[model samples]
Structure formats: structure tokens, C-alpha cells
Target: MADVMDIVIVASAFGMDAVRAQGHLKCAQASRRAGAAGFEVRRELFAGEAEAAPQRLRALGCAIAELGLWSVFSTPAALYTADGRLDAAALRLAFDEASALGARFVKLQLGGFVRDAAGAEIAEQTQDSNVRLVVENGQLAEGGSLTQFVGLFDALAREEHAHVLGMTFDIGNWAWRDVAPLEAAAQLAPHVEYIHCKTTMGEGARRFSAAPAADDTRFIAVLDRLPRDVPRGIEFPLDATRVEADAAHYVEWLAAV
Candidate 1:
């Protein structure tokens, strides 16, 4: 285990296709904004043929914490996409790229697959990788039911690749779905390699908000439950146009925590 207070920022929202395609310049310029400390290069870059993507990212002068290698597609619990069906070639290439740069770790999304009786959904881990992989559950369906995910994780823990693979638990997402954050954290603790902290609220309608891990009132308990040693990722959403303000917000929020 590692210190949870060693929080880092991972840039994904700003660099997702739409933002990067049209807002890249502004995005790049905004990195200097106050709250945007520890900017992270997204894993999408690995989707292309630049086998040296990680090296290129590091060369760009950004503070590299970890690079997202792959994200499984899911919206809550429904399997919108088949697991291991997305551009495997691209993911493999990306993994290679990240490993080549000697990145500390890679982030993976745990979604996209409808669990089968034999548990074939997690087949992707068998792919090449010497880098640490952090798998996160983003599309928790029915508001945080852990059944399917637990099955997946159990399989992952026994897989040959388990040595380098661990979990990325998002406290806010679980809370939004109405799960008690501490319980979820306890269930996820053993497998967690890193933490992605965010705060969310709402009932029939849902909203995702970014707050300091400590000030996220509902999730503070979850934070307390986390092992002091796990790596933390403070992934906050920012309004692209209001980059500076949002950046400052994150800085202040973190300072408060």
C-alpha cells in the first residue's frame, strides 16, 4: 500500500475526442492554469500508430503520473459494447507504447462486457503488458451493484496477469449510485491499486461534481476507509472555457482536504 494523500491529476475529459479535436490549443494553454497541477496525458493517443506515444507524451513536458491504456465501454451496468471487442490491436499497441516509455502505471476501465458463466469477458488482460494496470468500475449499473464486477475482479485476481494488475476505485461514482462509500471501499480495498476521487449527487436526475476528497461530505467516510498507502488520482472535470477558474477550484479543493 502507498499514501492516499499522494494525489495526482489525470487529464481525460479535456482530451476526449471532441475536446481535443477543437479545443486542443486552449487545452494545452490551460495546463498552466492554477488548479490543473499534475496534468496527465490521455490514453487515446495510444489508439493510433505512434508506437512511441508514451515517449512523445513525456517529451511534451507534462507531469506524467500514469497513462490510461484502455477503458471498457459501459454506461452503468448495461453492456453497450462487448468486452474485449473494442480495437484490441489499438489497445495492444497503446500498452506497448506505455510500457516503452516506462510509465509507472496504466488505467483501464472495467465495463463493456456482459459477464458469462465461464467468465470470458476479462480476456483482455491476457494481452501484452509489463506495466502496472489499474482497472476502474465506471459504469456501475443499478446504482453500484457489485455482483458482476466482483466476479470479474475475482477472475482477474487469479489470471496470469494479476501480478501487475490492480483496482481503481471511484468514490463519487459509487456514492451517486447510492452505495455507502465506505462499504464499497472495504470491498474494493484489497484489489485497489489506486483511487479516483470525485463527488456526485442527485436522485432521479444525476450530477457529477468535482470536490476535494475531504470536502466531499458524502464520500469523506470512504476516504477514511481507504488504506493510507494507495495512490490517489484527483480527476476533476473542468469547463474548457473556464480553465483557469476550474483549475484554481481544484487547487483550493485539494488544499482544503
Candidate 2:
């Protein structure tokens, strides 16, 4: 029989520093704007350095499939501030750091809403890194529109750049565009390399949502439609209190998949 497919829940949202706390390692923080709740690492932590964290994760008895590298405001749009354009250099550094740590993928935002020279430059630098770049289709203002994002996918899918680039489609982002998550997944499934399943709950203006990433009906429908080879991940943010409980919920929900 084929091995059962498994989904990986990345722990970076809990802060790199949280990895040291040992108490709140599985805390949910994917929803935070700052993504700085748990632990914060000033430098990269490689496979050897991360062994303790991973071992601790294993002891929790939850299946962690793989580790993900995450960054806040590291996109092309964020490269330039009052100082100068540093997106390329920063990305190179970040990618190398992620790669050194044995991370399977690196998650990044496009920087800003506008897609200009800086955006192009950022994308170019990502392509140059030779590591897998998993683009998150969230926060639409920052070149996150489905149409524009697909354009990037198409460009990257070309013969010359196809192997080095791909996408990490975040299911809930489309809901903000008023597009159904399943529909959005259908549209981008072909270009997707990984998946982060979550949901937003709002109607006519005032709406918020939550998740057991793989449990939501909309997310399940999207998963049903997707090719099984794609790796799906659970991502959500919760306060420190819900860490263990939420991780258990996530593990149970993932098993249902």
C-alpha cells in the first residue's frame, strides 16, 4: 500500500526565539501581523543547531513533516526605505540562511501593493538564489492579486526558469478578493508547489475567521481537487495559551485528510 500522505505545519510563526523556550514551541502565530510572538532568532539556525527544536517537536508526538523558513517584510517592495534598496542583498542572505538550516522551503511576501521596478528586482533576485521560493498569496495590496500572481507563475513556469521557481498558494487569500478559495485553488493548482490552508470569516465588511487548517470545508474541497503529490501545510496564529491544544487539533484535522 502507498504510504499515507502527510502535511507539515511550519513552526516559524511562533518566533525563532520561541524555539529556545521549549515550553511554547508549537504555539500558533501565523495570524499575527508582526509574526513575533514566540521566539526570535538573530541569526540562522542550521540542521545541527535545529536538532534540539526538532527533537522537542517529535517528543510532542505530533508529525512535523518539514521545517519552513519565514521572513517578515523581506520582499522587493520592502527593500527600499529611507536608506536605499537592499532587497536583493537581504534576500541572498535570507535564502542562504534558510538553505543552510535544511529548510525545505522559504516563505515570502511580494513586498508591497505596487508591482514596479522594485518588485521585478525582488523577483529576479529570488530567481537568482537557486533555492525554492514559495510565494504567499495574501495581503493583496502587496502585489497579491490572483491575476498578477498568476502572471508571475507563468513567467516563472517558462522553460528557462520553471525548475527554480514555483508557488505556495494560501487558500484564504482569495476570499479577500471575493473569490471562493476552491476556485482560486483550481485556478492556481497547476502552478502550485506547496499549500497553506486557512480561512477567513466575514460578510459584507465585518468578518474574521480561524482554522484547523486542513479541517475547513472549503480547504478540504480545495484539497480534494488538488493533485495528491503537493504538500499541504497547516498555518494559523493563536495566543500562547492555545499552543498544545491547537497543535493537537491541527494534528487530528490533518489525519482526516
Best by lDDT: 1
lDDT of 1 by residue, 57-165 (tens): 4443333222222112111122223453333444454455456544555655555534331223324543455556555666456313555457656654555434445
Output candidate 2 Cα RMSD.
8.4
Q: Per-residue CA lDDT of candidate 2, range 1-257, in tens?
A: 22244455445434445644543223323312222211222233223445435444333223222223232111222322333333566566557654443345555554432222244555667655545666667655454577766655565455245445456777766666777767777777777877666677666466554574443566777877766676656555534576555655664455457
The lowest-lDDT stretch of 10 consecutive residues in candidate 1 is: 68-77
Clashing pairs in 2: 15-39, 16-39, 17-39, 17-40, 18-39, 112-142, 113-141, 113-142, 202-207
Q: After aligning candidate 2 to the native by TM-score, how far in Å is the CA of 63 from where it should be? A: 16
What's model 1's lDDT at 129? 53
C-alpha lDDT (0 to 100) for residue 110 of candidate 1: 53
* Cα lDDT, model 2, residue 158: 51
Which regions of candidate 2 fall more than 4 Å away from where they truly are?
1-3, 12-87, 112-131, 203-206, 212-216, 238-242
| TM-score of each prediction | 0.64, 0.62
